[model samples]
Target: MIILFRIRRWLFKYIYHLIIILSLPLISLFSYNHLLNNHYHPKLINYTTLNQLYINNNTLFDNLFHSNKITSKFPISERSFSSLNDDVFQYGCRDPIMESSKNKRLNAAFVVLARNTEIDGVILSMRSLERRFNQWFNYPWIFLNDEPFNDEFKSRVEEVSSGEINFGLINSLNWHFPNNLENSPFFNEVVENQGDRGIMYGNMKSYHNMCRFYSGFFFEHPLIKDLEFYWRVEPDVEFYCDLTYDPFLEMKKNNKKYGFTITIKELINTVPNLFKLTNKFIIENNIKLPDTWSLFSNNMKFFKGENEINYKDVKNLDDFFRNLIKNTKYNYAKNVINNNNSDNDKQIPSKLLSKLNKLIINHSNSLPKSINEKFNDESYNLCHFWSNFEIASNELFTSPQYKAYYKFLEDSNGFFTERWGDAPIHSLAAGMFLNLSEIHYFRDIGYKHSTIGHCPYNSPNQLPYIPSDKFKHQVLPQDEIYMSEIDPPIKNPLINSNLGASGCRCRCPSDHREVENSGGSCSSLWLKLNDNNFPNSNSLTNHQLNLDLIENWALNSLMDWINNNGNIDDWEISQSERDLLSKNVI
Candidate 1:
């Protein structure tokens, strides 16, 4: 009996040990997975947890990742830690105060022109805007389509929008080629030629129709006509930052007529004759040029025998003209410079000299023969506020001046033959009609459309860490960082009070910089012409400033000469200098 009892005890002890040994691998695997699923997966962290983390400590990382429990159990390398912080930085910190109903809302609606196939893309844009801005204001949205919106598109968009949603069919007259031109062979030929030349959206009749519609008729639509203001949103575009305040209210409060986020040069080929047509209309109607007109006019100054053609002042003229001519075709340079004057030594007529100066300054090597030939003395700089995104009072478009301008362009058939884009049209009209102060640049908004995007960074003083080669791949500890850490804590240039954070919860790249002067952006020119402050303007060298000043003087002189009917007497040149000018024909 004693032996049997001892044998049972030994078996029980050995079996228990065997069971624990068999489960060891499984237990370790489960533990590892749990740590990864809970700690590594950022999506698992809910907004509530994030808000809690923010509340516990003002910083996102100090409380959550820096906790000893998480650090010890799930070790993170410095690079991984930095990457995690970057990922969190994208969400930015949201402001609950933005949810207050006491905030005044604007009588504005978001206008989207899309087709059924773009429903998914439209949903993304709608959801992004709702989360970023509209959730706070609850403004209504109006969707316009050439065809009826399908149930799926309507339901899906409705599901994402926080505000009341309405769908309307665009009038056929507004969205199609005019009945007179629909079957015109000339129109077809132009389309075919532009397509063959590979102009963006040049061959697509529907694309041109869409551009024309947006430029002339969208604002007049019944659904949008009643609204005081409209924000044009497009499919697949993204709003990367939180807009804590109502942009419509901002527009109204500041008496702004137009607002845009991205400014870029238009494809010169797409709008070959637009500038000429616009110039002609201005002259015929005696349209008063706005101060902002300089934004569109080329600022290059070519000597018109105004000042004694000092060799010192014109030393760089050779290189400047050389580079300009070299970039364009030889034939084009000849056409612009020849001016039918066979005699090269005799004094050129003041009229001919003025024409030559205007041609040289207005000419752009980038333009094709078709476009270059249309350059007037007051040439378009082609710096246009991209129209894909616009916030403006509806009154701006419905005004008689803009209406007449649109009608003139439409009657000329440039929208059909030349594939003129609405972007440049809107830009030119705004420059002509609105004051510099009336047109707002939404610098605080972070936006991305296809390849081009603008991601804003805080001022250098407000940056949490100044990126350097030494810490290029490292994220500094954000412990004990207060909102005051950002010098001034509130930098809303437009609004004086502390409203919801303007760019809160942005998920853009930490290293992404604003390409204001490069990559086809013309914001630099816009700033210089309007005298608005540019971020990098202070970095310009004194030599660059001198060159700019010279160009400005030249532009003003040329305009004055033209306005005065080529009279050199107004220039106050001495008779000897006038003789010297007359002796040379450039």
Candidate 2:
């Protein structure tokens, strides 16, 4: 009996040990799944649970993956998901159902500015837009060129376009340099210098003419003068997704004046005096700046320590104005003030002189604020909407305020001297004249110009796989070669549709981070400054919203770190690291 008891006890003990060993993998899988679910589906998990999970496992995963790099770079407190508000993520069509129902076609057209040589590129753009959105609405397309369109270009574009097409020649007065400066030696020298410096398209006089024309005169073209809205289309550019609804109508219904897919920082050298000139205009006109104007200004204190002047002190105020006027970049304004006919022969407008005097008087007592605060410094963040893919109301450009503003800049001859781009010109005008609510970010539109592009992904919980068979052999007629070369076979057919709604039949990869989430984009900053009047229509739950907010914050922090500490080109991921990242849900 004693021998039997000893054997049984030994067997029971060993069996229990064996059971625990066998169950370890199952326990591990459960734990991993729990963490992942919390990570991706913040909506499903409570805030307290997510915070606890982040606190415990963030350190453990630090070495496991570089995905944690963003969180690791910033302090845990600043990036904690718990600190973000639920409302920050709310944007876009405030009342989707209501807006969706009012589908009356807007009085809009796709305006393409191209040369005759760009027939093939124009057809590609026309066909893509037709297939994606214009076929259903049949919005007219108005084509304008510096010269008359040839028969071949017209025929090919009409053949591919779904809507009525009209071709027009740009007026010589509008397309060429102003008569006063056409042959000026100073103007010629500036153009030559710009080319020598390798500024983008600065060497090309036609490019400068194009920028100047678009900045001030395109909206008034005879072909499109009566039209209320226009979607600027460029040759060789692409629209990557199927737009299910009419964007023009959407803009009209929502009272949005401007819509864009990308916002980037403009090259500072291209517009050395743009901000200074813009600030001068703002103060002179006493224009009511938008609340979002703060995004453009760093709000750096102009005077520090003992140098700060009391607003009531007359001597101090005179000294400040004298320094400011002497330091100002508007030499044209100075010439007019000094009555230097040698520099500029035209008399300064009485209205302008009065406004200039008012500017000095108004700002004498105190330092200029808002757009005016950084007058002597590089105040502009250089953020601009890429005007190449703009959908905007014609009235925005044609408005009297804008026309005056453009004239002011044009008279300064900055277009020839500094190579001012239309993108920044349009952006600054939009920033000054329109409220944040008037601007719209087309998150759904996947657009590419030159080498840069924006591709939006599906939401996290949606269908994660894009069926490869759907796009395998599909190619637009005549676009087969270009399509094939640009879009290769999808190696990873997986996508997360639960994150956001991509356009219907979008062939582009839907798994990449959006431009708005990247460091280079100013869209997030734009949204952050959005007016609170818009209603919340985002369907994302609180936790899901928090996840997006956290991700954007982290990515921005990472980019800022890269810009300050190291070269972005030097920051690269290895194939192994990519593979590891691919295996895990980001």
Candidate 3:
């Protein structure tokens, strides 16, 4: 009897182990199906219970792993379950390296958007500039992709752009973890997490790259580190305004390092993960971070709990991220208020806020913008549009002092998560490191999905803040570009794009250094130019004019176009700039 009982116990143990093994694939299959059958969004939970589950060891795994039975389909596949390593995208490099530093070059390359563009978009955008203002493509364009650039894509861009292009490959290695799915330790758990919006716990290479971008900025990519300036471009992008000065020259003169378009509350989708990495940074980098780096509110309304929100209150954030904070007049009055001794050195309640903010932002409280202005050394500030559309020489990129740039990004394990992209971080880093006067906001460049804008002649400090003139304090040094407003806005527009399409213009309102183009729609000029009969040729090429005359003609013509077109759509050409720029026939 005793022998038989012992045998039964041993058999039962073996059976249990076998059952667990058999369930692994089934779990993965079911999880994948669930995600495919449903939309990928997290169900709401009570903050108290969420906190409890986070701390309670027993409920932690169960709550996190409890799958929500849902399904998804193919078209969504591209944007779906980015955390998994199943499939990814690729970017292209037009040719090898056209230019590089003498003693440096690594696996570095910039990803420029160059796909799904209009048939005559490139020519049209260029022609729009030419008919209105003859100009060359100022910034180097980079192309990125999940697949290789076919002859058609490459050939088309080459012919249209006159070979003005470079490419980056977003292969499995670069876009995702190098680990194999079969051998991964977290295989089961990753399967369980398939439906999660945040692509954590899997082989999401782009996510990883984005994280590293925020924390470990890349000044050393084989393609980028050696070059000081990178002008981010994308397919189907547009430029409606005429440029009077060289943005690249301004960037060099002022010492401004990075630039960007928008700044939203970075904590929305990033607080939890940002906290995870930031905590690691505190413990690992050995650098002393300021107090108030991470603060959370009990109220969800502030962060647009369930819907898209524009922030109306910039004054309430200073105490939460003290180190990176820029105390402007508006900030002191709006953000800091009377709290003289707020404890800024506390953990930010990352998980408390949702990814959206419903607040109606008051730009009047912002700092002066450098939209149409040139760089001014006396004040040493860099605030303007297309801050991200940059131009840098090899010398600026290879500077030894720039070592800190990429170091910060790599250390944060930032390149491993998909929740955050590198845009906001890059903007912040540039604003902080680049000299104020050296920074520039390109007043001419235009992108369809841009968040920042530098209108012609709109110098820094031209604009007033949204609420209080004192609210200008909320911005960081880098964000000087979007700090101020000249006349208050009727409204601020939303700028968006595909993944890495245009660069990630992260919403780090914490620094208030966002670049924006009050573009609720296309500039009126673009609308006039959209007529099929718009000039398809560059007449300036045949003119016997000197460089100065060429530039003046272009500038005046562009201004005329803006006047006639009313500055609404980006490239509409129905209204001509000055009835006619020149009568000399091409």
Best by TM-score: 1
Task: List clashing residue pairs in candidate 1.
Answer: 90-507, 91-505, 92-505, 347-582
Compared with the true structure, the alpha-carbon lDDT of candidate 1 equals: 0.61
- Residue 434 shift from truth in candidate 2, angstroms: 0.5
**lDDT per residue as tens, model 2, 1-586:** 9999999999999999999999999998787554333311111212243235334422222221112343234212112111111111221112222333466667889999999998888877876777555655567889999999988998777676656889999999999997768788888889989889989888788999999999988988888878888999998887765465577776776778888889878887898889999989998999987744644543333223222332112111123233323223132234346773456767766866765555445544445353323473327878899999999999989999999999999888898999999999999999898876677777667788876677543222222222122122223643442222222212222221122333333445333344554556665445434423211211111111122332233345435545587432233333333223222221
On the 0 to 100 scale, the lDDT of residue 46 in model 2 is 24
lDDT of 1 by residue, 1-586 (tens): 9999999999999999999999999998786544333311111112333335334422223213333453333222110111110111222233424433556666789999999999888977876676556765678889999999999998887777767889999999889987778888888898988999999899999999999999999989999988899999999987765566567876777778889888888888887789889999998899887766766765233334332222112212233333322222223324535745566565556876665555455544333343223243446667899888999889989999999999999889888788888899998999889887788777667788887777543321222222222111211122112211322223334333222222443445433445452446766454433432221222111112233333344445544664678643233333332223222332
TM-score for candidate 3 = 0.37
* Weakest lDDT window of 10 consecutive positions for candidate 1: 78-87
lDDT order of candidates, best first? 1, 2, 3
RMSD of each: 17.9, 22.0, 27.9
For each candidate in the order shown, give its overall lDDT on alpha carbons: 0.61, 0.60, 0.32
lDDT of 1 at 567: 43
Clashing pairs in 2: 458-500, 459-497, 459-498, 459-499, 459-500, 460-498, 460-499, 462-498, 464-495
* Order of models, best TM-score first: 1, 2, 3
Best of the two (1, 3) by lDDT: 1
